[model samples]
Target: MKDADFSDLLLIRKGEKDLTLGGGDSALAPVVSIGEWEARKEALKELYMLTLGQAPYHDIDPDLEIISEEDCGAYLRRKLMYNTGADERISAYMLLPKGLKGKVPAVLCIHPTTSMGKEQTIGNDPSSNGHDRAYALHLVEQGFITFAFDLMSAGERCFSGLKDFDTAPFYEKYPKWSSRGKDLWDVSQALDVVQSMPEVDAEKIGSIGHSQGGGITIHAMAVEPRIKAGVSSCGEWPMRISKNPFNAARTGWWVGRPLLRPFCVTGKEFPVQMHELLAMAAPNAIMNISALNDCKYTVEEKEFTGEAFRNMEENARKIYQLYGRPEAFKSITHLNGHSFLKEQRKAAYEFLKQHLFK
Candidate 1:
């Protein structure tokens, strides 16, 4: 269907006047007090859920099944699968640190936009160069039980013979549900699996991701309260400020949400923006890692410079401060271009450790 043919129904239930673009200087309605923020948090989550489409039923039990186990020196890696819905099951790797004396902190490791999926997070992908992308392995070595899983369109979950993300089958099966919704649900279920484990401290769970995984990290933390702390590396930017906000490769067709097409075509302001989404994670520890040169011209020439990251951070910080937990929200920027290297990985790990362990 052409972009213009998509429905123009308002994605958010609240009127546009009540919403703000975030940041100190935005023209939209700014959240001023903690009471105001408390009333708006649920609405903002509902608005984001509207953009993502219908969520899957969560009442079904995750029938956990173990497929295999391997000894990896510092940790034991177990390949497993569990039900996220009545019919849907997702593959994951659960890394448990050896010689555990008691229940330990756990982290959900999310991979970037690679076909390697959970494999890259565990250092099993040769194409990942080194241990930089193997953050799950790194975390396990640091004594945190780590769970890494394949997103719907990546790794083992990708369609056979497809090297890149394929959303056709997903849309065909769940015509009304968006891929983003499925992802968010899967993440929440993954947390359920982690909390069920006897070796894990249920209350100490956190999440970390890079690129696409990073964006999912923010979304998951906003809606999934089980995620006590989160680290997102170069994962997001304000959609309204993006050059091609609704292009296919950006947040348009890939997200499987056609409702955004009307706004893109008419150049209308989005009722919901990324900064508002970030604010929804208030009181919970969240660290945003951005790169100054993370630019891309695939759909349209646009650069996610450090300046843009700071603007979004500044806006989200206002909400965290209102909660009296200003230090819970942290951000860092590097000169690297669209990449998460060793230095950034160390900082992310340190942040997660401080919040989850200390």
Candidate 2:
């Protein structure tokens, strides 16, 4: 994003390490939901089930495959050769930066509303979600290796959204062969690939996404410990009561149905919100990016994210106080709406540099 403005960010090199874990201003006091205090355990349990699917990550065959390769900037780009069978394989562009000399700290880039594999991820493309900001690509330029894959129903996942994310003919012979809900499982598999890579520093890994990608990143980070940090851009971490496409995601239905509902759904009350669950990811660096003009992003929406983050920081401080870096769980909002404006992206970059690099 050539037009991106980093002038406002208080840039600081990573120096102090906050190893302290659990409870601080970032955390909230555990509370029972107004409607259902007992709260069902299955919600989180379902979350565990939600991020993964029956699709085995160790299998020889891959639903999403790489189709092409290119060189952009200082990174090696590979087009994902993938076909989940719901449609064609998800069309995605993977970038491997030249600066990443060896087992490098890695990050996963998730896109907003459009398909995955955006040429703009690195900031050169103009046709796609033109923000002049590419978090995935920006991270690579910063010296940390990163991964960006198309989710089912997105980019290479399929032209269709989750309803038809995969196109395997077997789905033709089967029932609900392609539920984008299973895409999270697809992401889980993607993690396996990232983890398996010899050049990726598996221990210092992270995931960052915008909007829709933000939703997935939060879920993935919560369930997968391999990711040490998570950044949600224009993503709703607060779990507002609004009907966000991200909140009503098929994955939510899939996980909450039968298994997490009734017990965890506490309709009138919530034992905890999605943010509370995320708080469990304390001590791990976290940054939430929100835009004001992006109409889809609301005050209520951010409140949920902010309150939850605040609560989590409190939870984190109870155990470890040195990293007492209670400020880790934080949020920054742009006056603009639903979209990630220039300032928003800059905040994200600064946050990552502070935590991941440090």
Candidate 3:
């Protein structure tokens, strides 16, 4: 047999169409006025709700149960589990400062890419990953009440007997359900639990997360307006991609078969680019934290992301400006990699302090 003549499929390297969600002529522009902003916000929220699966229609009881409590110097730490939905329970750590009186600002400290889940946020995991620093403790020490919870597929909630990174099964099981949507709803439910606390100032709630949690933070703020301020660290910054599966080298771990498959349909893209998602958090004090060398993007991809970040900032700024709070939206880029480094952490804490506390 002649060495297999293989010009049919392997030799022709052209793809069906380019990934053109929001690029060139289709780029989104800043909305013109407050009225326009309001209209756009409502439409975008509804669109995302549909895309990510509508928020559970029924009420979630938020069954708050404190399993354990401990006095840890500057704060009191309590381990609790609460129902974020009819049957969805979230295990969390609630930190309350020792001597504070009256209601105080509260923050939801979301964990990064870790199987240990809420443990990383509360300093309980004891893992060496730099991203797992005890951010909740830092917030409590700074006099802010804080809550940290296991994201849906992480920690105690990983009922599938698989690692947290293995999230596709959950998505596959529920056709209309998405990990992102469930995570977003959990954030809202977390806010509900925080507000119910007499020591928490319901009007002064903020959220901060890194990596996986960081991406969720953006979506959470977009869907839940009650999040008064948010800080997203090195999450979902890349909006445009080459459409070629080979581009996996640049898309990182999120674009593979099954994980983000729902959003990765051929020739089509998410109804809105992520920058629009950033804009969805407009009029609220929000900050985007980026690592110049975050492991998620290649050098060229980083340049593309830098430009995109600037564009997103400008778009979101326009909304904040229309609301007469131009200073409320900010983006900070650092030299760190994908992990939640000290600089980003400090910046997040300061941003939350400026908006939620002041």
Question: Which candidate, 2 or 3, has the higher lDDT?
Answer: 3
N/CA/C clash count, model 1: 1
Please, what are the lDDT tens digits per residue for candidate 3 over residues 11-61? 112222452443333334445677757776777677666666544446778
Residues 1-358, candidate 1: write the lDDT tens digits. 1111111111222334534544243233445677667667787777777777665465778899999999988889998889987787888999999999999999999998888889999998777454677889999999999999998878778877755567777777886777778888888889889999999999999999998889889988888888999999888865655667664223422554656667778888666666766777778899988766554523222233544565666667777888888888988887666778988989899999999997
What 10-residue stretch in candidate 3 is worst by lDDT? 1-10
Per-residue lDDT for 23 in model 3? Answer: 32
How does residue 121 of candidate 1 score in lDDT? 92
TM-score on alpha carbons, each prediction: 0.86, 0.65, 0.82
- Candidate 3 residue pairs in backbone clash: none
Off by over 4 Å in 3: 1-30, 54-57, 130-132, 241-263, 299-303
Model 1 residue 294 CA deviation in Å:
1.8
Per-structure clash totals for the candidates: 1, 59, 0
Which residue runs does candidate 2 get wrong by more than 4 Å? Answer: 1-69, 79-92, 116-125, 159-181, 240-266, 269-272, 292-327
The model with the greatest lDDT is 1
Model 1 per-residue lDDT at 108: 96
